[model samples]
Target: MNEPLIEKTSGWRGTRELWIQAAYGALLETGIDAVKVMPLAERMGLSRTSFYGHFSDRKDLLDALIQLWQSKNTGNLIRRTEAYAETITEAILNVFDLWLLPDLFDSRLEFAVRNWAHSDARLAAMLEEADIIRVEALQSMFERFGYDTVHASVRANTVYQTQIGYISMKKDGPSDPLAPRLERMRTYAEIFAGQPVTDAEAARFFARHPVNET
Candidate 1:
């Protein structure tokens, strides 16, 4: 008896989403070396022919994953920071907290990406552009808080770098839990903005700690 191939209803968008999700999952579980087209195709329960219909090669899949990441996380960060004009500082802190908290993505995924970036030019460029967008978003928030462009830019870079450093350090060795650090960063940001920190404000600081620790 011949079984029919069940057509996927997800169309191109669904197939692309599955590809990106699978790539991210594979990278997180086994690093970049494990993300070959054959393995990915197997994982997706699709034939090489079907996979080829979506991506030209492994590099193409990686490129698509990078675009998806930027579109979802980096793009949303920019939009949320801009849209929350009134509470710019709090909004910015919220964005940072999302990344810093546990269980969102294994911190190891970030570590792996950083190392992969060293050898892969395209990934490196994407990382650089993402950082620039983050800094720019922070600068805009600072300006809304009444800081001049120069000061705002500097502060933005400082905060942005501090986060990278914090994540890198956590990846390297022992450190405080992400929740406490996030709260501390929020308090510092409030003081940096020359505003009094309210308990309500501090409460938003530790809100997003994912319980499923990776």
Candidate 2:
């Protein structure tokens, strides 16, 4: 969780990034309704008027948060799909790194923005675009591995939708054992890539994402 942003009662109006951080933290921790100016200003220990120095209004701040979500979550996922890999299975594992590596994609922000998109039509469209972009990237990944377009499309959607559904359901646990999950990832690779995940490929994947080593 982000600590409350501090601003003195004097002329220190606070930076735009500071206000954006507070707003983002609020949106992720609470819900979109809690991202109003007064609540964020009160939470940040700042005056309501000070927020205008950074953004025109709460809507502006929300816009920034949406952009932030796109850059951090969707952008990273696309990059992961484009990463270097020698085989289709390895390429699939490369994309899986986004789920295992915390510094890559912001799952919390993804979840929050997805929930926020439910009532906002503009955001809903944006979310759909991002999802299409992501799935296209995955589809290209399969295509690069010599799969035909139709087969690639089906497999990519399967991989992308399965992960998105997992994220939406929020079934993550920090203290869960890693070994079984590792095996699950292997099975996932075989299913999605339509090929076996070799021991070496699994070893290399885990090497890059050893959040909890054996």
Candidate 3:
């Protein structure tokens, strides 16, 4: 059985966000090839003409997608990492929260963009630049925690590369359940932070970022 396309909101005449979101969702679920205007229009149950009102063309949409990735992933992450933390471990834990929490950062979107980059040289270059920005932010966090420049850089690379590797490697299995997976992530975070997050701290974080199972 096939699901029906989602209809547009009634009397909706606004900015380009809905269309952009549709494109992003398509890119995540399918690939760059699925990001064409007609398919997205079909999914949104909107006329093809509506997309033109928001974007000049497909290239415009792609450009918007790139901008969205930069602002959402890199910009938001740097801000989160730079937020107040009493210790280096806490600071790193703050950053780890973004990875663990889906609402903060979309790992599937990141993977989709990386897959898109494999075929486009210019996109690949842009992705590389974004990666540098992200790693530099993490390095700055380590430096703020009193690490020497060299060691901070190395630690930053370690954390960032571990995540990149995880996304890059494709696995097929009946995965371990969420609780165990999250526990393992906590262990990984503790290793990176050089100490376990206290129960109170972990509780506070969970309160703020309750997992969305829906």
RMSD values, in order shown: 5.8, 2.4, 3.4
Point out where model 1 deviates above 4 Å. Answer: 1-14, 85-88, 100-110, 171-182, 191-194, 204-214
TM-score of every model versus the real structure:
0.73, 0.92, 0.85
Clashes of 1: 0
- Candidate 3: where are CA atoms >4 Å away? 1-4, 8-15, 170-176, 195-200, 206-214
Counted clashes in each candidate structure: 0, 0, 0
lDDT of 1 at 163: 61
* Candidate achieving higher TM-score, 1 or 2: 2
Residue-level lDDT tens digits of model 2 in 75-181? 89899889999999999999888876667877878889999999999999999999999999999999999999999999999998998887898754234566676
Clashes of 3: 0
**Which lDDT tens digits does candidate 1 get at residues 18-128?**
777778878877778888877876676666677777788888998776665666556666765675534656766665554654333335555667767888987899788
How far does residue 212 in candidate 1 sit from its true spot (Å)?
Answer: 11
In candidate 1, position 166 carries an lDDT of 59
Q: Candidate 2: give the clashing pairs.
A: none
